[model samples]
Target: MATYDWLFSTLGLEQWCGASGGSAPTSLSDLAAQSRGETGEQAVDIWELPFPSMDALNDACPAFPQSRELTLGLEEGFLDIKDTLSVVLDPITQPLSWALDAALYGILNTPWWIVIPLLLAITWAVSRSWGLLAFVAACILGLAFIDHYDYAMQTLAIIFVCAFICVLFGVPIGIGMSRSDTMQNATIPILDMLQTLPPFVYLIPLIFLFSVTEPKLYGIAIILYAIVPVIRLTNLGIRMVDKNVIEAADAFGMTDRQKLFGVQIPLALPNIMAGVNQTIMMSLAMVVIASLVSAPGLGVLVLRGIRNLELGVGLVAGLGIVLLAVILDRVTKASLARINATHKA
Candidate 1:
């Protein structure tokens, strides 16, 4: 007999399972019914605890009962507000949907020959490193050879769009934070919460806020999850600007705006670039988890592998992500090095 069976019977709750007939529960169904209080039977003493517990007055209360009611309540509450939220956010997010779709479609449909050369040219222009260019070219060609070119491109498109949006807004917010200690104090806590929260946690509210079919659903999640680094680093970069340099600019009769653009930003470029690098890396890490909400990329195949227990598929997809990550990391770091070199020169 299950340990809880006696507790139920003693409380006169056995009737809940139709066991008031005085026959012991004969099957799991009886136990289930008894547990659910669904057998049209009433407990003789409904106030009695079903499980053992110390007197609440004499000892610390035991762990709270695990219940699904809270989850149900949240779902209901979200549903109640979902429509209002959708109406307000849809207009703002619709453009993001268009941008993401266009990028993905263009990248996926473009020929390899054209895409490869263009990417190599960009890499060379940024880093001017033939070795880095060759490495990127090989990575792209390898992905294509393995039939993951489309998936790789899809992942790249999402990253490109999301990262651009992150930098677009994040830098300004960082600048604002640097200018106001009150703003920094107020915003740091929020950034801490966002950064420390599990990547999967980002999807929970987003899933309820928007439909899975919408690109902004995952796009928003990616941005929120990956944006913290850039913001924090940007603020740090600006704040770290040498005071002497600012004074020199001031001596030269530069205005606040001029000093910021000419002195602070130029000096802070390296840190800002580092922040961008970290943001890109974080975005890539989230791509797989974001797939749960219908974001596509190499992550889809990874999910497929896990669902179907396909070792080769998961491994190959994982390798593809690693290659993509390495390529991005190398190129960004190379560009950062180039920027540092230019500053030194």
Candidate 2:
């Protein structure tokens, strides 16, 4: 007898329980026991309750649904809408694929001599610190020495393209949020969801939406994962600007545009830069995960190491990633410091 048998019979559910046929329906445990040449009486134990499951319930009534059916239905529903989604999303996202491919090609094909000096010059220009310039140069040269330069560049190229797009779109959305309480209230929930979701979860829907061979597949994932910080910080930085300063701008007969660009944005630059720093780091982290969908870079080496059990390969690639992270972090922080110093002056 099933665990719910007594209740079913008491409730006059004998037909549903298959007991109207003059015998109670045996549970799965009973059938298993019989198959094993043991009677239900021998296998039954009070200590081990035989819980009625979906399978047992379905056995009593073939019309009832099972758990697997629920999952199958969900999958079928998604598949039904996938093509329609792709039609709308593909063209809109195609530019991202082009940009990613172009960046990767340009970075990989560029000679190290040119890339290294140009990076050092940019670092010096941004920070105006010889120390930072030297450190960045050293890190780049070290990766080159280890023959990881190309892979490192591949990773940087992806970050460069995706992070640029994140900032481009995130800043405006943030500014909108800062200017309107209603916008902020509506957007906060979305930003919270994006920030808290697991990194791998970003790729699952994308995988179904586009083929893995497409560059935008991974580009979208990296952007979605890394964009939250920039938007949040941009909004915070703008809103945190001193009201007195804004009032002074108003006294000068400045319009909202002038107040924003000349006063709020300049004052908010430091926080915005900090957000950029975090966005870059998050971009790098997601780039590695995006490699699961064919994002080229040091991540491919790392994944290969895991798949093939090659510890040295994984360790070296990981070290290269750490070096890259340090390089980016220092450059952005130094730039932020410069902005703050200029603001104070």
Top candidate on TM-score is 2
lDDT of 1 by residue, 252-282 (tens): 9999899889888888899899999999999
lDDT agreement with native, every candidate: 0.84, 0.87
How many collisions per candidate?
Answer: 0, 0
Q: List the residue pairs that clash in candidate 2.
A: none
Top candidate (lDDT) = 2
Model 2 C-alpha lDDT per residue in residues 172-210, reported as the tens digit of each score: 998999999999999999999998999898898899999
How much does each candidate deviate from the true structure in C-alpha RMSD?
Answer: 7.5, 3.5
RMSD of 1: 7.5
Q: After superposition, how far is residue 235 of candidate 2 from its true place, in Å?
A: 0.9
Per-residue lDDT, model 1, residue 159, is 95
Q: For model 2, what is the error of residue 49's alpha carbon versus the real structure, in angstroms, after optimal superposition? A: 8.3
**Candidate 1: misplaced stretches above 4 Å?**
1-73
Scored by lDDT, model 2 comes in at: 0.87
User: Can you give the lDDT of residue 345 in candidate 1?
Assistant: 25
